[model samples]
Target chain A: MLFSIHADGPVPIYEQIVAQVIYGVAAGAVKVGSFIPSVRELAEQLLVHPNTVARAYQDLERLGVVTPRRGRGMEVTSQAPTACRSKRRDLVRRRIRDALREAAASALTPDEIRNLVDEELTAVNGKRR
Target chain B: MDPIIETHDLCKRFGGKRAVDGMSLAVPKGAIFALLGDNGAGKTTTIRMLTGQLPADRGSAKILGQDCWAAAEKLRLKVGYVPERPRYYDWMTIAEIGWFAAGFHAAEFYTRYQQWLDKFKLDANARLDAISKGEYAKVGLALALAIDPEVLILDEPTSGLDLLVRQEFLGSMVGMAAEGRTILISSHQIGEVERVASHVAFIASGKLLLTATMDELRQRIIRLKLRYEAEPPDAAVFGSVLQTNGSGKHWQAVLQDPRLEALETLKRTDGIHDMEVSTLHLEEIYCALLARKV
Candidate 1:
């Protein structure tokens, strides 16, 4: 599975994993019943702790995005796409709320904040494309 | 809820020198807290005090709500300590050592011993005297985990391991933390600590300089590299700039800003060609923080 993380972001590494997996499911990169790498493998790939990856997997499982199968590793669930998308939207909303708070604190105009968000969105989409 | 580990004005002295001076910290429960410092910076002394192996010259420490020194016997049973250089009986095999260490716990050792032996990939038949240093460290870690303690205190657990083994060891520690075990690890390996620790306390010259979450500390330190069109920028606003070199036209220095308010100070300066605001790794920040004290 393709996994990408933003090292410079404010989010913790585990949360980043959670967000990315949610994004992956929503984008169909990880389909229903698709097997994800073991915690050790993912942590090695990300140069993080296996426990960090495990935390993400556990969180995903709690949200019904993935199911843990003993020694078989984690697998995406049939309800993953919708649940993941919902979770992603909630996360994005929280981020926006935080951004808005920062903008207000800095006394930035709505246009300036909107333009900043637009610029970030454009950059993200441009990279994806 | 009370902190799982706490010290109030804790001090440790050796002869005339004080290793830890007036140190105080409270680590939240179920968090991976790290102590970052240079050698002789009191990291080891702090760990010893927390584990109740050494008495504090002043103040006190509490581990799991029990006095670290006064109630050491009961407290020690609940705590698992992996010293920097863990020693084992050379005459014993890995299995024998496991069995010996397991004697302290009230539970059956076979299941947990087998689990840890598999987790650490240690051969039960291998003798402690014959294993490599890294292997020995793994055995020590396995012994620590097999006891099923409430708190883990590790002092440079992966100090001498190769990169691969170090990664594996850290992976195992992280797994332990996932099970809601509180861990306090002291190590000079900032990158590895950054991977697993939720909080960090940096010490220097026997003093606790800063204690904050990993995310909070990252946001506090900013690395700025500037190329000016003229002479070097004035140093008054940036607190103290260290290592200002590159002749008169260009200069670079690591600056300290506890609140990261220096960016505004930089924006006010003129004759600047280019500047980049970047984050400093934990190692760089540790070095800078200690260097400033000197």
Candidate 2:
């Protein structure tokens, strides 16, 4: 999987890996039954500690996103798509809520906030086109 | 599991100055523990004690449950050491140096040393004196790992290395730790070590300031910026602040509040009109914690 890790970002590196895996599965970029990189492989590739990657893999396993495949590496689970899509929605919703909170804290009126959100949606849609 | 390396009140004095003072640390097995500090902050002194190069003035240090000073010779066989500037006989070739080291280690050393030479891409026939500093360091690392020691002690091993060599060194360290080997490295290179270190112990002025797992540090400490409509309260209002900056209406603080109770309280405080709370990267966290000492 393609992972763009921001080592210096506020998010912990392992958490970033976990989120990216979910995002990938949700977007259909990572197919079910495909194996992700092994802990050692990902650690060397990302130049991070193997333990960090292991922790991410362990969390993914617990969340039912991936499963150990005997001698092979971790395979994406069949149920991952449904679980990850809902998780992705929840993640985006939380972010939007935080943004709305910030807007409200700025003393913007509700109408002003609504218009700002509309403008942001239009800009994002334009970029998509 | 017991810590692979542990020290309690480990103190060392160089004449009147305390080079290491009352340092207590635990390096868990299989951990990439970074002894982080600025130059002259007693990192080398602590490593010296741990490697049994210098006996501590007071207290004790143990590696693999053996006293560092008492069983120095026995511990040497089980521990691999790479110093900041590794030195070898100038006339000896790289191959000769490895052969010389293999004599003191297990029989497997010969094959492992050769494998490492190939992996590091060092020419076996290159004279130690003729090789670049980076190559010299690589030779030292190769010899150290060839022993297959349970623990590796590195004192600023990457100081003279180039960017790619440093990355290679760190990648090798990750690979080693994955095999259940413990590594203790002393370095002031916070950004480079941040990715590989599982736990970090911050030392300053010969004293240990903090020791924590990287994940714990990430989850606990919080950086907060607050803007008050009126004058800001005393910095002490947030209880024990690690570091604070700015003044009057605007203020910033790094607090070690696991539950973020302080941040929640400040958000509801009467005069505070705006606030921003976020976790920091390791480098930023290190500086914020050390700012008070400076």
Candidate 3:
């Protein structure tokens, strides 16, 4: 769905697909049993190798978050929400680690960094309303 | 799964100059392998050897289990080669050439050959000289597929093509790979290759830098920018240091692999204050990698 990828960035294209799909499921943007884009479809859309998309789909299937049908293509499994919730934590942790690293690099004290995080959280929550 | 195409210490020379020197690579079956190198990097030389056009001075090459040089005539029917700049027969119409090549293939393959013509939307009656470069590429592709080749070698198929033509060409390549045909494409277009290639090999100065799945290369290469309170001493904790720039407190180095422990050690070292890590694109990594040889 509404996914953006940086081709020049360090993250591999297939891994990007894996991360975005998990986020899509966790955020309820992708419904259970809904059909995801096939390997050819996504490859044409993303201008990536079809095998890359195939690898991403295979990873999702292996993790029990997606399933393959004989003729209907791949679909988000009913377990997607539950599986994605746990996967989302690790993804979030990696982001936070990078953000914290950046903050420390900026010479900001830990208390000030914590205050900045709180302020950002308040701003995000205010927009959620 | 054995490699459908492979070369062992392949060597070639033109006069006193070495064109391809001790070059070796393997293309596993069903892979879309991108062979990338700068101009004069001997990519064409390597491809010529694999396609049985040029014999190696010292080494050997094989295609689909047959020795390329020893069985050149037999292998030509099996390995389809599309040159970067094809010299077409100006007198023949696109359909005429297709029919000419069709004689070599089975009757059933002609059906698929016709299908490919429709897929490319090529006017069969159009004379070869009247078509655009893109259309000429389609004609070449049509002829290649008409032969029912098991492996396709395309040299710079998308070079100088417009966006739409490149899209169509790439689309056809993906479709071909899906059908289990091994593809070895040589091109300077890193972005396009990154999009459609399952595996990639880098060659420079007739020497191969590396060959790996696209994901593996991305995972191993990285860049680190450091801002220390004082000048930091150089260290080689990772594999190879491709580049190091900046001076005094602000220094940036591109390392092959910046693992956690190596980074932590950099942080733990004296005078280190702040650091940032970034991943490199394939193009940028190749420049850095090739620069070492010069």
Candidate 4:
């Protein structure tokens, strides 16, 4: 899986690694049975502590996103794509919910919030086209 | 598991000044522990004591459960040290120094030293004085790693190196820790430390201010920017406020491990109209922590 990490970001490094792996699987950028970077490899590449990478890998294992295989560091599980799709949706929904909460807190009317969301959605889709 | 390196109330005095006073730390195996502080904050003093180069006047320092002061010679083989200014004989070439250091280690030392030199791309015959500062730093690290020590203690090893060299140095540390080596590095470079260190200890004025895992620090230290209708709530209302800034209805407060109750109370308050809470990077957190003490 290929992803960039922001060392100075608010999100912890390990969480970033876990999220990126899930995102990759969800997007089909990483296929099932393919192995992700080993802890040592990722740590060296990112210049982060290996234990941080290990923690991320462990969390991935617990989430059923990846499994350890003989000689293979961490192979993506068969269920990883489906599992990650739901996880990705939940992650995006949570972010949208937070944005909606902020808009409501700022005293924007429900209709105004709807209009703003629609506007942004159109802008994003238009850019994609 | 027992800590690979530890200090208990370790105190060192120099001419009546307590350089490292009642200091204690526990560094587990495979940890990248960063010791951070301002200049003259006794970081170097503490590192020296841990390496057994300087004796503690009170309490004790231990590495691998052996007394640092008493077992200095025995522990020497198990611990590698790279000082801030690693000075070798000016006329000695890189290869010559490697040969010189090999005398104290097993026969494998020379071979490993050569491998590291090759990896670092240092010319073996380059004299100590002829190499660039970055190359000189790499030489120090290469020599230290040649011993294949279980623990490495570095004092500002990358202080003056360029960005690329510094990144390379930290990358090597990541690989070493993966192999279960404990590393204790004292540095003022908070950004670099944040990237690589699993645990961090902050000291100031000869005393330890805070010690925590990076994850804990990330979870706890928070900066909240609040705008009020009239006047802001007393900064103290936010429990564990480290520092507060801004004036009038606009205010920013950095809180340390704030309680949930305090946040709820702020949300229910009448005057507070808006609040934005964000996590802090290690550099920002360090500044807020030190500024709070001031």
Calculate DockQ per candidate and list them: 0.18, 0.71, 0.48, 0.82
Off by over 4 Å in 1: A2-27, A32-129, B227-262, B265-273
Error of 1 at B209 (Å): 2.3
The stretch of ten residues in a row with the least summed lDDT in candidate 1 chain B is: B236-245
> What DockQ class does candidate 1 belong to?
incorrect
lDDT of candidate 1 over B1-294, digit per residue (tens): 889999999998999998999999998877789998878989999988898889899988999888898998897777888999988899999999888877777676556877988977889999989998889998887777777878999998889899889877877777666667888999877777887777899998689988987667765665666788867766546655533446656666666553246656675678776766666777877877777677
Q: Which number leads on TM-score?
A: 4
Residue-level error in angstroms, candidate 3, position B6: 0.7
Better of 2 and 3 by lDDT: 2
lDDT of 2 by residue, A1-129 (tens): 799988888788999999999999999999999999999889888878788999999999999999999999899999999999999999899999999999989999999999998999999999999
Alpha-carbon error at B244 in model 1, in Å? 5.6
Please give the distance, in angstroms, between residue B101's alpha carbon in candidate 4 and its true position after superposition.
Answer: 0.9
The predicted structure with the larger DockQ, 2 or 4, is 4
Candidate 3 Cα deviation (angstroms), residue B243: 2.1
Give the clashing residue pairs of candidate 4, or none.
Answer: none
Number of backbone collisions per candidate: 0, 0, 1, 0
TM-score of each: 0.75, 0.91, 0.88, 0.92
Report the lDDT tens digits of candidate 1 across residue range A1-129: 777765445466778898888898987888899888888577656656455687788898898999988789898999999998887789889988998999989999999999998999999999999
| Pairs clashing within candidate 3 | A49-B195
After best superposition, candidate 2 residue B131: deviation in angstroms? 1.8
Q: What's the distance in Å from true for residue B70, model 3?
A: 1.2
Per-residue CA lDDT of candidate 2, range B3-49, in tens?
99999999999999999999999999889999988999999999889
